[model samples]
Target: MLDHCNGHPLAIIALGGVLATKKSLDEWESVCKNIQSHLQGDEESYSGVYDVLAMSYYDLHYNLRPCFLHMGHFPEDSRIDVEKLYNLWIADGIVSSTQDQIGKERSLEDIADDYMNQLVQKGMIQVNRKVSDGRISSCSLHDLMRDYCLEMTREENFLQIMYIDEQQNASADALTDKARRVTMYVGKEDGQSVLKSLSGKFSSLRSLMFISTSTEQDEDEDSCEWIRTLCRRFKLLRVLDFEGRVVLKGTFPSEVGNLIYLRYLCLKGTRITELPSSIRKLKSLLLLDLRVSRVIIKLPNVLSEISLCWLYFPVRILSQEYDNTQGYEIEDGSQLILNKLSHLERVSEVDLDKVDVKSLLERTSMRNLSATCRQKKESLVPFLKSSTIKHLSLKIDAGLLTGNSEMLLSKSSSLRILHIDAGSWPVTQLTIRVDMFPCNLVELGFWYCKLSEDPMPVLEKLPNLRNLQLHICYGGVEMNCSDTSFPELTYLELDGLFFLNFRNVKMGGFPKLLEMAIYNCPLQKIPDALHPGINILCSSILDPLANEYRLRGKASEEVQIPNLNTASEEDQMPKLCEFPLLVLAIIPFVMLSFYFCRSKKH
Candidate 1:
């Protein structure tokens, strides 16, 4: 059956999809002959793929067309955020919530999510990133799928994307009355000219996105001028995304309030330290994304101007970032954050210092809450007591997290999803008892903690946990599992366990564990046993073994095999030359072995 069709994967898959319905041999051969004859003339890979993709595209539910096509507006291979994308789809009037007489309802967001899953299953898109709770946070299209999107978008007059990298700038000849939305992906400095010349050129333009092509060294000297120029020309824009750029000299331009029709404003990567008061004028705005950008720092204290006093000061501040290689001090911003940010909604995503957690609890009723707890607020019992908050993402401070501070998460009857991120804190080695965590947590993400102690004992007590991730716990000793651990955990991931000892785990420890991953960890091999149901995905197991070989002076040593080779073990250089590699690899293992030996002795 496979011999009749060309070896093209898409062609084979498409033929298989068609052939699955055929019950009789005659029906199968007749359909097979038709496919084989069709392949006789058009042998190009694109043709085969086009037919397969087209067939699958038409097979989609009618309501999914616009949502699927809308994704083409994003830059090729772009990491499209699911929340942002679905919100855009909703705002674009592409999909809406629906309920039948049977009382089953599907929200607009849910519909978009289902469409995304459909596309993913059909191999139209790939998951690029997942959030702490294992939801598809971001996804990207394949090169072929992206190309198809471009072709379909142009043909349908949906969205016109202009690239600054291409010669002659694709927008020069492409702008027309039909182009309702324009996305300028900046890759070169000449993007200024492209925008300057193209202002007011498209009367139908309702959405304009200026995405930075590169995050490195993007110094937009005339970004203010660009904003001024854009506002002057495009007055009808519903979505103005000047995000991921250093906007208006570290200040949000006050004129942003003038865009009364604007619905979404994303300023995630901007250098803006203070939001101008005029922002409150955005009455039509539904989402105001102001997430701080994540930058790697050699010295965490360098951003002390902002991060310091994380406990009490108003988060909003008028300040410059750490400019010099040697860091600089910041002016005290005690009054800057409190007085400036006056428009705090009841249930909003804001800086920890922006609004008091108490103030938020009093003002409104909310189902989801995200709050930051500085070292000062380590006693999380107050926030956990809030009965309204079911989904909570709490940011933790890393400085010596051991005090009288205890997080009895199980006691929080409301909290189902608890995301704990110890941002930029070094956990050289910290012991956390099982009593400190919430027992009823359905999802727990202990990321960036650099824990040095075994977490299995601490986590396995959570009977209701479905998804658990222990990421970047660098100085960990071992991941030991007892017999009655993880009774209901479905997904378990242990990442960045750089110095793991890879010790004890019973075969039936995680009886209900559906998926398990141990990545970027120094584990030579899986434990000798595992539950029959657990999919223990321990990739990069070779890295530790490679280190082990380097330890025995066998990494690059010439072996004494009785075969035709250049040199034998004794014929090589002296032991002194191998000293560095020996210490680099073997000394640690020796210490680990000694520790185990001593442990057994004890």
Candidate 2:
């Protein structure tokens, strides 16, 4: 079957994907026979490869076909955020609702994740990046695959892409009005004009995306007009994405409330400082992303009227400054009161100092929380006692995790991933004990805690930890790991530990480790032995053992250790010398001699 592919990479990949699900030899034989039949007349042409790619698409189930086509809506070569894609799929009904055998309903996000995994297994989609816990964060399609998807979308009248520029020759007649989704790539300076041109054209549009292609600054006066136009015209919009594309001046346009049918609204990376009261009118909104936006002082209680499943805000937006003179009152205080939104499941970067953690948990159905404790004396015990929260990120003073409060984390049986950052505060000594961590944690990280002792002895006992990161969290000179420790650990990262020792790492330690990274750390050797396929990354400088391993030629396939001497070696090579002065002096004489020779010839 591969021989018929003419050694084409895409064909081989597509063919492998097509055959991956076939269980019986008869089915594989039938597929190969069909491919041969397609290539009978034109074996040298790429039509056979196209057939293989098409077969992979056609193999998708009815529910997954639309989800696959939706990938075409993103800009070419851009990494599509998987979380955003899931929301879009849910909003568009591409990820259909399902129920288990016991008649319990399943969430749309779960179904979208399943569909994405199926496509990934079939090689129709490529994973671009993953989070530390082994879940995909972003993904992309190959250029050839993206082209195929675009062609299918055009044929199905699913979506249209417009590159908004002066030279664009697309006429109203040429642009299909049936395409329910439209993506516009335009310069920041031409944002308003482009929006004006696209108005009322695709009245049936269900999704609209504005992607900025230029770095030019935007004129805010004209910016809100386009948004108002969008709300008034595209009344049926389900997904409105302006991520990093526009700055909504000082406030969100009240006109957006007109899109009552909107489900996913992304304002990420924008400069909007405030949300209008009218946003409460979006009763159908499911996801609102304000990550990396300018500070928003207050969140209106009216937002509880909407059914939001995922809400992300900038870290400092919800944090407030206490006015000691005013007693318990804060200056421009922001209260996170989303208790009425029963469907809300995830919220990030909430200020625990102002918001009661226990009250927030009991009032809402949120299971994923990211909060910050800015007050130096704030208790972290409330956060550690919760057994419902699955993913937690806490940025607090280092001293807050001491004694009984630190031991409370082990009570969080439901926690899967945890990150603690105490970089802002000064602490003389901090100790980490094995009993202080939840046994079920799959990923854990510590930053700037300046621990007085080595944590490896405690961390290795975690039965389920797969990813571990220590960024200047230890102050000791030496550390040791017992043999056969870290049975489930796969990735380990050490950063900013300039004088730490690695000589004590046992050969059998980190038995299941697949990758290790050393950054800004001067180490002479790694563990004596490791798995054959393990990957080692040394960012700053490679020590003697690493250099020797690299020289052995076995490191070429699995290791990413940078060769620091390459630049210096190239610099040391001999160079050509120039006699510019002598050449300049002879130039005039040579010119005069040439003139005399010409006269003699005349």
Candidate 3:
């Protein structure tokens, strides 16, 4: 298989995928011989391996063909997030939602997830990473497979890819009527030249994605004239995804509102400072991704059509950066709150902490939000009860996690998921009163809050909390879980607590806990609540005998462990004897202990 593949990755994966379905050894032998015959007999200059790969592609489930093929639109080997890709697929109506899936109470996203998992299992796609929820968060295709995909893209006009490094390849074929989707991978600084050269060529284009491969300053990107021209030319565009690489030093042109049919507009990693007030004209816009764009502020208020927004940065940073430019408007101690662009309403789902509470009240359509910008306690107090917010993640840097959170609970009584990530401040205990958290919170994840005091008694009262994750970055002595606490929690994940004392478990303690994962912790004993569900991770365990010896104050064992190199001395693995038994003891508790044992022995 290796020899026939001739160092091509796609062929190897395709061969493996085909063989996985063939259970008989004779069938495998026949398939292997036939593949070698094809490779040896082929005289064409094109990749012989693509023949094998084409079989895999053709064998794909018919419903997934278009969805898989459409991936050619993205740059080769792009790390496409599942959220982004699934949304794109759904937006394009590539995956049809069946009644069977719906009958199982599965969403289209759930069915799509199943499809992606099957594709990965069949070696058609590669999984990059999985999140805590056991969902594939990101994925990438092999370069060779991406090349084959691009070849098919050219033949079927699926999407046009223009390589800036190879100007000769940038032909009129891309500007033809068939080219509906075009992606410009700017590998050189001459993108301005290329754009100017291809001026008026994109008439019928629907989707235009720009991926900047050049690190140099793209000055042309800052100008509104080129953008206006592009928007004016491509009046029928539905998706304009810059992939957040273009740094718009100026305002996003008002001409963008002219594209009445636009649905998805992503400018996540850009330096876009403001949105022109004219943007409210986009009546068809569904998603507006402005996440991580620190310079953005003063959004147009007339947008009632937008359903989802991805703005995660704080607004204070925007005020700080642009305040000097508008120095003439400076007043007394308070910064002038940028009001909404008139009385427009219904802005849903955002991280708009930087916006004034007065203006936030007008945005009555807010759903789940994660805000980093701090607001005056009094100013935020009223809306806590008035708002119908569900999931809330407040990144309170000024130690507001312990603030009067009861105001939050009172206002957003319908809150379900609450994530509080403590900022730079060092908190050692729960300062907020017992009634701060809402009784209906179903999930909670806290990060970096040093909460020295265990407030389990308060959290225990939350009747709906089914999942809880605590991630403390620094060293901590212990966190005590009291009797009958977290009774409804189905999943409990604790990380970075050096010591954890599960001191007590009264009758019916954690009655619904199906899984418990502990990481980077030194838990000496198993709690009475421990069942087959408890998972003491490899990174958290120590050999009982070794720990006992250490308790007896002896480092007598000559156990050698690999030492991590601090200096750049060719990464030599020198021996060190400090607690190798931790590595040895971690074997039995692994998810599949027998598999781990076999691998360790091998």
Candidate 4:
């Protein structure tokens, strides 16, 4: 039965069960034969059953293959880098177990090529063949295929509608009433008139994203007025991203506060300052990205009551200066704000630069805090001491916290991630002494600071340490005398350190070390006796023999060691000489002679 039709056995059985009541086996055979005979002249001609069978094969192959599974990491609407996707699949254990044999039999690159061709033919993926690199650099799925993938995977319904330059015909009116998330990308040619026309149509939308790809032009009142009208209409929107090319000239309208359901608001790269005092009414906002907005106004004092987890404000100066003379009115207001947000939790990540610490501290409990400080160190000291911030990044001068720096370091107990950029500090005689280091520290980065002393003692104290990055720092020359170790360290990166010496360094300390990257460092050689259980990857081959020995597992306990002197001599000799010499030097000379004489007699 299977030989009669060129169909997969599983697909054939499933389809046979579905069509069993309609016809007998002989009847099905007759229909399949008709399909085959019809395709004698026209290759594309096939029966309905044959079409269904082919579609089943395509769906099964796309869902089960590693190449297609890896494409799921990219956003549905975005183009993906094929090379990067393949590398990630290799790392994630998605490739076949017999990958080495497959590579030798039919090239690993060709396997990817064939799979991409099959997917494209099946209409499950679209390929852009016009790239200059002669490789399929980018690929995306059609909307119908994407919808099917989403339904089969049961992925979380995060985004619903995405209109990227589809013609706004009468068919789009069907989307007006559905209770789904929506994203609309507008090109430069889509003017205010188009937006005004559709403003009344999106009454039930959960999200509206407007991406303007417009070149800079003279700002007019009509453009700004249209934006204001759109904001007023979408009062129930949960997320809004009106970025790029749009001019925001007038003061923020107080009517924007009516959007009480707004959770995420991004107004990046706009020329606007001073949010309306009514912004304090947006109590449900979770994230606000206003970076490069050049807004120089003091934040609303009521900002402390909002439940924001991520906030990015990279501008330099805020409008209101911190003053202590305001007495109980200011103090009570701040206390009420903090007490209301005491239950606020930290987000996964955050990035801010050159902001006032007082304004930020009152708003959120940040898990990742990346910001520069404009206030004095003393002003930031209290906020650092109060919160259990996991990640703390600061770009400041070393002179600010010189005399009494212990107070700042001791309070950061919950800090697992720390990034310090000490600009323009002298490296010749620098010392940092903390009473107790962050015990839960997992990742640490240092930039433009000189240590002169070894940081091994400080690093070893962090039992959960995983990653350490030192950039443009002059501190690797010193070595600690104690037997301190980083047992859980996995990644270590050193960049632009001119005086680094690791000759006497041992590698057994880092049992879980997987990667080490060093660039622009003056190291003569890497240590020879690293753990045989792990792979060592370096940019250049300082010692080829050692690398080969590691790759072949010669140093492992399972392999017996030969005579060191004889092995060294043999390894150094020419490869052609070694092969013949090995065959000539047998275990017993008499046995070889007897074998040759017996063969001659026969």
Candidate 5:
């Protein structure tokens, strides 16, 4: 059966999936015979591959059929954000909240995740990257499978995609009115021209996206104008995404308020200064992302009218031209408006200096928070002790931990991921002990803490930790890891500890480690126990050392070894005698030749 696949990955995977449930060899033989009967066409044509994929598609559960078809809405070879995709699925009404076997209701996001996992099991989707807690962060589709999806979508009128280039003439007439979702791929230089050509009304469109090929181009002031025109045309849009693609500078379009049915709005990495006053009319808005925007928007009081579940704003001023006040709302007046949103769940990054943490935490349902504190007296104690927060990232001044604030996180049982960065003021004292962390943490990171103690001893005791990163955080010369330490650790990184020693790691340490990265740390040797089946990244100076360890283990990993064969050959050759001996020998010969030449001349 495998031999008949012609080494086509999709066909092989689909056949494997089809045969996975056959318990006995006879059953497998029967299935193989049936598959061979269907694969009786020309191998050069992909008809056999398509037939296999079609079987997989038809085998999908009725609920997953639409979810699989939705993959056609994205451009080719794109890594789709898992959260964004899930949210879009929910907004499109294909995935809905459901009750579990135990009668507990599961959120639509959870259901979508399970759907994605099932697709992955069926081998239709590929996982691209995973988060620290073992959840898929992003995913991509195989080229052949994507082609199949596009074919299916066209037959079903599920989506329409326009690729606008300099040579292609894209006009309103080019699009079909049946496509409910439209994704336009255009280069930054020609974005305006493409927008003008797409002036035709899309009455049936519910989702729209603009993906720019060039991201570093300067902001075109007219980009927002076209969006305003688009808003007037597509009043029924549910999802409007410009995530990290096109840059919308100047004011956000007021016409966007006309999208009353909008559920998801993304302006991430844009140059927009503020949300339009008319945006308060989007009562159905669920997620509003403004992360890394040019200026920290002065959220209007009318923002409280919407029920947002995910709201992400900039933590710092991304543009150098903007002043401190422009990037952060130091005034506490408008900041208090966050407390009134009853449905707000996820937010990044609120400035600690301006927000009243107690009120914000007490009034809202935020579970993921990214906050920064530049002030001298602000405390992280409230955030660390919150049992509700599952993921927390804090960039704060070291002085905030002057008192008993260091032990606050021990009470945070629900916190899964924590990162504390004190890189701004390294001169101050920032103490982090093992007892100060929660036992349930799945990922932890420290930056520029400059601790005098070896953090490995304490961090290893974190039984659930899966990922750990330390960048200029340790100041010690030697660090130790006991046997069986970090039993569950999968990823480890060490950077900027210039004088650390690595010989102290015990034989059984890091038993589950899969990846390790060492940067700018000049270690004489790596521990012998850490040499097998681990992906290692290091500076060029340490490449030879790592490869030597791999060779000692007879590992087949490839590494570059610098060549010095010619230099060694040159050193092995004979050399001339000392200057005095050579001069004497040359003088005697010269004297004989000179005497003979003189006699002949005479």
Candidate 6:
């Protein structure tokens, strides 16, 4: 018997076998002896013996067989909280009678402890001790053991379906008998009636997921009504996910508020913009994912006051009522409302593209700001000057940075990180006077700017420069002049510049350079003299490397050539055989040439 059931023979016999003889001392003794004999036959018999003894003792003490059946509820590979387990046991009334002879001497907790210890010794349960709480907090089951438990403990008449893809009538016919859990993905045509049928059949369902796979264009009112009814009926749903476009055209049903027990609500890529106001009623909601949902109109004003540990929403100004200001508010003071969220230390990103930063700067206090400007450069002057900002990102039209370079650099002095996204042919040169720029700057990024001159002059002035990025800066810019070196630079990135070259720039000499990334530059032959410690990353090395080379032509004339005879060895030699010998050789050579010419003429 022990060999047939590993160590869980008691649960198996109690759940599967008929009553053995009668419920008496003699019958229990006989059963225990038989189990013990079976265990004694194997060398791996210790665990089997313990299981038999614990089960027999439990049966003798607690008459109901269902008391031991509840252990199968713990999921495999997951820990069971001791307090929760104990509470569930008490609620199920699994305790032995106090009037019984064997039960009178022990408390139910003690009996449960003994059973747990026996299970541990029999290799059925693994106990985990949490050090922080100083308690035995959890119990886990092995896969094999859990499967055995499920097999022995599950009701014989229970139904299990893996995947269901049928019409509503077919599904309804199949679900006529009570099923434990049903999982089905619905097509657009059948999405409505299928959900209605499922809601009626499976009220006690543990999980329901309606995955829409259709690419249908039109969503009718019946579909929305079907979803509304499903949300109402599945009040006890633990996990609800609308994977595809399951839009709620009208407001969500107020009855959806009853899903208070929902743990995960994922509405990824849905067109539904606004959540029902009743969404605030879900106090137990742990994860609410509304990514890529275009229909969200506005987040509730009370959201800032709630103690939500996780939230994702479009960046907006906080309400003004939370601010300490009263009747003295300005007429266009909507920008001032962002100040109310100053206490939100957990907010990591803020986009102030459309808001009036002049008003917001007076009240708002943010540590990280990502702003996109639809207005002119002067309108963003106040936000650039913010002292609380640590990271600043700007995506503005090219004209904003033209004459405002001084103003931009002035406000940048307090910034540690800066990202500027400018348009093509930016009104201003991508050059800066480094002397007045921020000394604390660590990272600088330039995007889509026409940079014809070297950017090193400003870069070298930054004492704390660590990262530099240039994207789409065209017009054949070569990095020359090693005078302005980044001593603390770690990362250098260049991307999407067709004519940018990194050769002969002597970038290898950067003392602290760690990583370099070059992509889509279409260049061959990187500078052979790169820093040995620096790591180079590029797409390919080819003739495209010529794109980074800068061209220059000569603007002046050449010097006159000198006569070779004037600087001969004879002139320099110190009177070798006297000057008369040199004159005699010259006279003879001249006379012989004259005599040969006279003979030719005669």
Please write out the lDDT profile of model 3 over residues 280-356, one tens digit for every residue.
67766655665524343446544433433322232232123242332111113233242432222223233334345
Q: Between which residue pairs do clashes occur in model 3?
A: 384-411, 384-412, 385-411, 428-452
Q: Which has the better TM-score: candidate 1, or candidate 5?
A: 5
* Model 3, position 432: C-alpha lDDT score: 41
The TM-scores, one per candidate, come to 0.66, 0.79, 0.59, 0.51, 0.79, 0.44
Assess the local accuracy of residue 160 in candidate 6 as a C-alpha lDDT between 0 and 100: 31
lDDT over C-alpha atoms for residue 252 of model 3: 72
Tens-place lDDT digits, model 6, residues 1-602:
44534645544443223235346877655664566442322335345644444444343334233333444554346666664444334333454314347553343444545555544544445676431112356777655455545544444312233223444443422343354434354555444656545644665764454445445754553334566677777787655656444554444455666787765565554544445657667765544544423343333333333222223333222222221211112223343233333322222223354344553464333444545443455656776676765555554544455665555655574555656654332223455567535677677777655554667655765788777887765445466536347777877887765555555455434577666676656445555455554555543222132122211111121111121111233333425444665465346334433443343366
Give the TM-score (vs. native) of candidate 1.
0.66
Stretches of candidate 3 off by over 4 Å are: 1-49, 95-108, 165-177, 187-191, 216-221, 306-349, 352-419, 423-450, 453-602
Task: Report how far residue 78 has shifted in candidate 5, in Å.
Answer: 3.4
Scanning candidate 5 in windows of ten residues, the lowest lDDT window is 559-568
Clash count list over all predictions? 3, 0, 4, 0, 0, 10
What is the per-residue lDDT of model 1 for residues 40-116, given as tens digits with 9 covering 90 to 100? 22546466565555544555566666677778767766788887676566556565557757986544445666778
Root-mean-square deviation (CA) per prediction: 9.3, 13.6, 12.4, 19.9, 13.9, 25.0
lDDT of 5: 0.68
> Which of 1 and 6 is the better model by lDDT?
1
Model 5, which residues run further than 4 Å from truth? 1-7, 18-45, 101-103, 171-174, 215-223, 315-333, 356-359, 362-397, 501-503, 523-526, 539-602
Window of ten residues with lowest summed lDDT in model 2: 318-327
True lDDT of residue 430, candidate 6: 54
Candidate 2: the clashing residue pairs are none
Clashing pairs in 5: none
